[model samples]
Target: MDAKGSKARNKGVVACERVREEQHRYHEQDPQMQRVLEENYDYMVKHLDPVMSQAIEKVLLYQPDQAADFLAQYFRGTLEVKNYHYVEFQRQQYYDRKVRHLLALAMNSAVKDRPDDVRLYFADFFDARTKFY
Candidate 1:
């Protein structure tokens, strides 16, 4: 982790280390932001990466339901601690692509098999799976 991030995480309460400025601001349909967060989290943290935060905000503004899965998968990816600010561009791209593919598989499934509004049930599922994150 960078010096600033290290400091934030080291705080007793885990102050968020976020990036608020970046190349893009809003992309409601961006795969990166359109997560299906599996948590019962009432709100987002302050330290989300700027690029990712923009995407998530857009999703929350437009497609709030998807944010759950997007975030849960993102958390899972971070478990390995590989692709981040200093990672090679290609490696980052690969990581993003892999996660996106997984999200697609998870997100699209309930739309057809369930008898009720799949979005709600799927949202619940996402919450159950990622709430610990």
Candidate 2:
């Protein structure tokens, strides 16, 4: 476990540390700009890398004649798809929670031996499950 942890840390954390040291030296002339850059470094790496890396990889593979235009369209399409999936995910989560809640209520009703409550909860659960599906 220790060896694996050290190896993973060496791979990316070392690169991050080296980049920070270089940023400090290069941006020494502007302390404020350096601070801002340091603050955003992690954010850029976390959010931008996945999206930009894919775009760059495709650009390298295709070698488009107009690289800028190709990248522009690629980013637009990517964002559209991402937005769509995000919305769909939210809907799915909501339905899942509703179904789970109804099922839990039905189970509780059964435990209490409340026939009417059990029937109501089960009815609602089946209705939601069918509606969502």
In terms of TM-score, which candidate is strongest? Answer: 2
For each candidate, C-alpha RMSD in Å? 22.6, 25.9
Clashing pairs in 2: none
Candidate 1: tens digits of C-alpha lDDT, residues 25-112: 4444354445534221212222223324453443333332234444544434431223222322343454454334434544445433
- Please give, for residues 1-133, the per-residue lDDT of candidate 2 as tens digits: 9999999988888899999999888777688777767755654455444555675565444543333334445544532222211222343454354333433443444344433332343344344444332
Q: What is the lDDT of residue 117 in candidate 2?
A: 37
- Candidate 1 wrongly placed segments (more than 4 Å): 1-99, 131-133
**After superposition, which runs of candidate 2 have C-alpha atoms over 4 Å from their true positions?**
1-34, 78-133
Count clashing residue pairs in model 2.
0
